[model samples]
Target chain A: MASTEQEVLEGLAEIVNEETGIDTAEVELDKSFTDDLDIDSLSMMTIVVNAEERFGVRIPDDEVKNLKTVRDAVTFIQSAQS
Target chain B: MTSSSDTRIVVTGLGATTPIGGTVPETWEALLAGRSGARTLEFDWVAEYSLPVHFAAQIATPPEQVLAKVETRRLDPSSQYALVAAREAWADAGSPDIAPERIAVVVGSGIGGVHTLLNQWDTLREKGPRRVYPLAVPMLMPNGPAAAISLELSARAGAHTPVSACASGAEAMGYAVQLIRSGRADIVVAGGTEAAMHPMPIAGFAAMQALSTRNDDPAAASRPYDTDRDGFVLGEGAAIIVLESEAHAQARGARIYAELAGVGMSADAHHITAPEPEGSGAARAMLEAIETAGAALSDIAHINAHATSTPVGDVAEANAVRRAFGELAGSIPVSATKSMTGHLLGAAGSLEAIFTILSLHHRVAPATINVDNLDPEVGLDVVRGEHRALPEGPIVALNNSFGFGGHNVALAFRSV
Candidate 1:
């Protein structure tokens, strides 16, 4: 089943919040995980792995590099789940 | 190069999260009160694995109660304990005004992150390689505690981890003394931390008959110097101390606990696990510590013995003391604190060092509990029943720690 974009964004935000302790409200789609969320590479990897499990999608190693922004991750998870 | 001995090193602060207590004061109080920290394993895995030894001197307080959620999640238990102890020690030192580059951190561990390593391995086996945590490597490394503390303090002089089994903590402190005296750093946060409470280590020690199987009476399991003692009771915790050059400590007006007068280390090269029967190496280390401090054997007032309660180990340490001090060994009060603290392994030396410093500062030596019947082979004047008061005036105390693979360290601390 394909989830809507808003649902994917909220779910990814929750994952980011858990991993980086960033407030979920601030995990806007436009924000970069590294710059805006202040997530380091290790935390970013953790968030990615958790997002894959949550969204029921396989976020390949190559795809991790392209996920620079919250929107990028949400979009990728949405498409991969579909 | 300036000779290291020319610059004296002093202990500015002490911290510990041990089985007996969560902080230095609490631990010291418990030590003086003769409280035992050993208890049966409460984890469900104890039954799940049926480990032969079912008790340990677990930490008095859990790290989660002290550290932030994110911090606990990121750091392994070993690192968590180290951070907790280091924070307290740093605060106790009044947060020295030294530059970042002028301070260092050295923490040792007998086994580094066994909990993390085994948990990650289980994760890998169950959840696949991709599921392994990204921070697993850093969390499981032996240097993790030192690195974490260095990062916390922004200490840049150096972050070193000396792995010497049980002597790791003492070795780290000894290294810190050298670092400060050699002008590498003026202040160093040094100690040891261990969190190998999992069933694997328990079972391994059980297989070797290295752990006390007194599951029914955990409190009396660690009976150092007693004739009935079978082996040591495994323990997990961290003890840290902030060491600064005397000049720097005086300049900052830090409360000096005691001076780290001298450190002696030697290797047996005789056996893998069993100590040299005659304790030649151990005696040499003890004598060297006194000589390095430029003090006579009679100057030694108290000894925090490395008596882990193991039958052979206790006797060996007793022999070492007699060999080192000769006639004077019987006069000096010996306190086998492990009888209460349950053998902290890597952290044992530093925790006992802290106990020794507190003893010197308070002018009393804590009693060695659980010695109902002292071994006939052990001839030292082991303090038991009640804590003993020290005579007034300048005095020196020794904290001895020996590790498997024949590592021996004797640290001498003098009353300030």
Candidate 2:
């Protein structure tokens, strides 16, 4: 099983931003990429690709389509890890 | 009674997440420069499956470089590619200030979220049903790409998916044109996306002998119209274009690419996997498109062919081209771009349509790469090696797409 929510967040924080010298903590779970983090579509796709690599599980196209929030992604990762 | 002038629909913006490039400009540049996106699989499952055809045109820029860590976990790769392309097109269209009800989205795919389906099945077997994510249904659905775009644009007119195998993308663009012409929507985001570079699809295609087995030369493997052409190479990517009514485009001062003159669709009803031997249905579709556009056969200067490099498919499409062009067949230049891009399956048609429009806009038709020995059976003028320059002044080009289910679609575009 995966770690607790906070631990998962801490682990994800190490992912690192190639553009800006920052951590995943800069991206709030609820804030939309277009609005909050300034993440574009290409950036969003990179995030998904990284998540699949990190979690070692494949996220389906349908589920990825609805992933507008950070919580949706974390919950999905948790389920995949289980 | 005098007929009113037909409303001209033009391509206002283009976006693509293709095997060669991430955006439309990048893909277009690579396509013209003759870059090959095909490469061997880096995934470990390739060795496990013992797949014969190992290479594929995976997206040059992976989505992981762009998406957030958590956000990436929830969606399938197909949807991610679609969204990536859609955002570029939407922004390229200057983010039109239109009501949600007046916008529509039509993005199709041959195989939607197969990666998600296979992976989830692995999870179910390795772990348990409770471990499966709840969003599997949405991810695996064929309409996932179109639905995601609809939500992004807040399109309410309708969101549609045309799953006509390889012709899916072209058909979606056709549907978008109709939506605007029929007064359903003022603008539409239309194209196709596919991320089926998985072990199952690759193994399945290899089993069917549908993919090229020239693993030694990945780039030269997808050789359309060549004497040694075996089969198409599998590819993954998305291409989306913004189609708007002429009136709306003029009002907004949009930079129009080319007027989407007309579209013709037909069904072979001959075979599920094979095209009609004489290419009757494909010919009919092309002829219908010419008639719909009210253009003479001689008006078409070029054709962006959906030559998937399959031995039978190439000949069938070649026959169709010769039949449709008739006396002008020898003059019109036909470009088989799959020579470079491989078979994008569902997204082939839409991306090819973009190629056609660009050819018209720039007056330069990109050459069909890797055709060292053209099949003598192909009668039409097949452009090869270097790009060919088109004759000056209002030129029309045809984009053809044919799917596995014998679905034939032809779209005609004229320079603005």
Candidate 3:
């Protein structure tokens, strides 16, 4: 089942929260993982892997660099799903 | 180079998460009570793999109970145990007012992060390479414990890991004394941590016949110096001590446990796994420790022996002690605490060092339990049946720790 954009954002936020201990409310779409959320590369990988399992979407390594912010990740997931 | 005696060093604080106890105080109390920490293995893999040995001296309190979830997830169990012990020791030292550059961390391990390495290997083989954790290398490195503690305390002086198998902890402590005496660091968090209680190590040890096979009676299995002793009971945990220069400690009015007067280390070129039967190398380390401490034979009152309870190793260490002190070795009250705590591998030295220091501080030596019938060949005065009270006044205690690869370390602690 393809997840809606709102559903993707919520799901991604939960993954980020679990991996980084950042508050769910703080994982806004505009927040940059490195600057705003303070998530390092290793933690980002963990979150990405977890998100892939949770949403049933494959986030390729090449595309990981393109995920600059929460909005970017949600947009990428939505496009991949469609 | 300045002599070790010129710059006095003392143990300001101690910590441990061992089979007998989660903290130093608890372990000390259990040691005094003559309690056995070994028990039957509870993991299903023991049965699945049909491991000959079914028990080990597992950690009394799991790290997850003491550490936060995020910390536990990122660090390996070896580092987790080191962090737990280091934190306790630091807090016990009243969180010394030393600069980051003036403090260092040296935690050694006989087998570091074996659980992580093996588990990751299994994951890689079963789930494919992509599924392996990114932090696997850092988590599995032998220096992970020292690095973890250095990171935790922001220690900038130096982080060192001396891997000498079982003697690693004591050697690390010996190195800590060098660090302070040589004017490199004012305070050093030195000790050892090991968490190799996985099925693989158990099977490996069993293959070598290094472990006791008394699956039915685990506690009595590690009977050091006992005529019926078979082999050592595998164990795991970490023990840490806050070592600081006397000048720095006195300046800050920090309480001192015991003065770590000197450390001696030697190597037996005889064999890789087996100790030199005559114990010449071990005796040299013991004699060097006493000489370095500037202690006369009469001043040495107690010994925390490295009696792992293995049939050959026990006798070898007994011969080593007799060779070192000659006639006086028979009179010194010796305690093989491993009979209760089992062999903690790398952490054995530091844990036993803490026991030796506590023996001096409390003026009571903990008893060596399970020696129902002491081996007549072991001529040393093994303290058994009940704890022995030390004579009042100045005295020194020796903590001996030997390891595979022919490593031998002896440390002397003088009561303040």
Candidate 4:
């Protein structure tokens, strides 16, 4: 599992790139998952579930709402893992 | 777009990704060569699930062969097949110079994305609901194929999908003819596709005794109008045609294959799965199509019958032909296409439609293979053993398709 926020963001970018057709380089920390990445709510859920599996963490549905950006998802994954 | 009656609509292009071959020319050649597309499926789930009637006619060329990896990953197999055939038809039409606003798409399917729906459900159960693919709904949608083609060409007129069991493809063509006849679109990409080679559908159809259980010799399973015929063999593929108004085709110097003169549609309103035993509704559909085309019964030279190889269905369709055209129907050589291509379900009609158009264009009728003994109940002429050439003159052909819900469609085509 990725320990640091940078490492978590990198992993998230890769997963997002695979799940969605977005370019890996474009999945920056500040990029909004919906607006910037253009991922719908279902795909956003997919990204969260895939991230949880990748990081070995549990992302509850309620917390999923706060994961609006790449940074938010990365931070949440880091916190959940710790 | 006002009504387009009194004007002619012609089929300028044909495309198909079927069990026999991937393209129209290849499929026609295979059909004429008396080839059978059926073979035992190699999926692991077959043995694991113990699916009855293990054979099927899978597509000869998969969509992954033509489309990009990412493209295949995003779309369901049904849409993938549609896109492959639609692209071929579009290109074959010389990429007709028409406004996007004046274009349309209508692709039908008996069942859509069954594989995706089932696989996603499996994932949901095993890996939890969150593990399922996000685009499952769109991918599983029956209209996905038509929508994908509509988007590919930016067809602004409309994107329609008619889900009428096996008759869906013919119904889609019927709807396309109406769209053009109604002046809603100058050009319409129309056809049908199916990719439900999954274990569930096979098991279900087997449970209903709708599929042949001749696992020993798969090729001879679909012996439509033949005495040895047991039942239909499941097949999957897509077929599309580029239909344009005669005025539009002539204006662009498009090579017209046949005139889509008319379409007749009706329903048995009887059974849910089994066809109307008498085929009275099917007969009406054929008669109405000929009447709608304003062509005399004597004018029909060829017929692509919906002989799905089922024992009951074959006799009913034969009776329908006789009832529809009287004694003249006996002389009309009928091409029982399912004998080779198997039963394409939703895609059967368009594939047969393409075959009919090519038959009229080439003035040759492809033989139905594996008919060692013709059933006496089938009164119509079932072309077998060898391909036969047609008379040298303007010719008209009819294609019949009947579905589970007793839905029936008859389309009339004439050579240019």
Worst 10-residue stretch by lDDT in candidate 4 chain B? B1-10
Candidate 3 clash pair list: none
Looking at candidate 4, what is the lDDT of residue A19? 70
lDDT of 4 by residue, B304-362 (tens): 99999988999999988988888797899989888889889999889999999999999
TM-score of each: 0.98, 0.85, 0.98, 0.94
Query: How would you order the candidates by lDDT, starting with the best?
Result: 3, 1, 4, 2
lDDT of 4: 0.89
Q: Model-by-model lDDT, in order?
A: 0.91, 0.85, 0.92, 0.89
Off by over 4 Å in 4: A1-10, A23-37, A60-72, B1-3
Candidate 1 lDDT, tens digit per residue, B1-416?
23266688899988899998999989888888889999988999899988888889999999989998788888999999999999999999999877899999999999998898999999999999989999999999999999999999999999999999999999998999889888899999999999989899889988989999998999999999999998999988999999998888888789999999989999999999999999999999998888888889999999999999888999999999999988888889999999888888888888889999999999998889889998889999999998899888999999999999999999999999
Residue B45's lDDT within candidate 2 is 84
Compared with the true structure, what per-residue lDDT tens digits does model 3 show for residues B180-293? 888889999999999988999989888999999999999899999999999999889999999998888888999999999978899999999999999999999998999999
Q: Runs in model 2 with CA error above 4 Å?
A: A1-82, B1-5
Clashing pairs in 4: none
Tell me, per candidate, how large a share of the native contacts it keeps. 0.62, 0.00, 0.38, 0.56
Expressed as tens digits, the lDDT of each residue in B83-160 for candidate 2 is 888999999999999999999999999988898899999989987774565577788899998998898889999999
lDDT of 1: 0.91
lDDT for each residue of candidate 4 in A1-81, tens digit (9 for 90 to 100): 448988888888888777766888999999988888888887787788888888999999999888888888888888888
Query: Which candidate number maximizes DockQ?
Result: 1
Tell me how far the alpha carbon of residue B330 in candidate 3 is from the true structure, in angstroms, after superposition: 1.2
In Å, residue B210's CA in model 4 sits off its true spot by 0.8
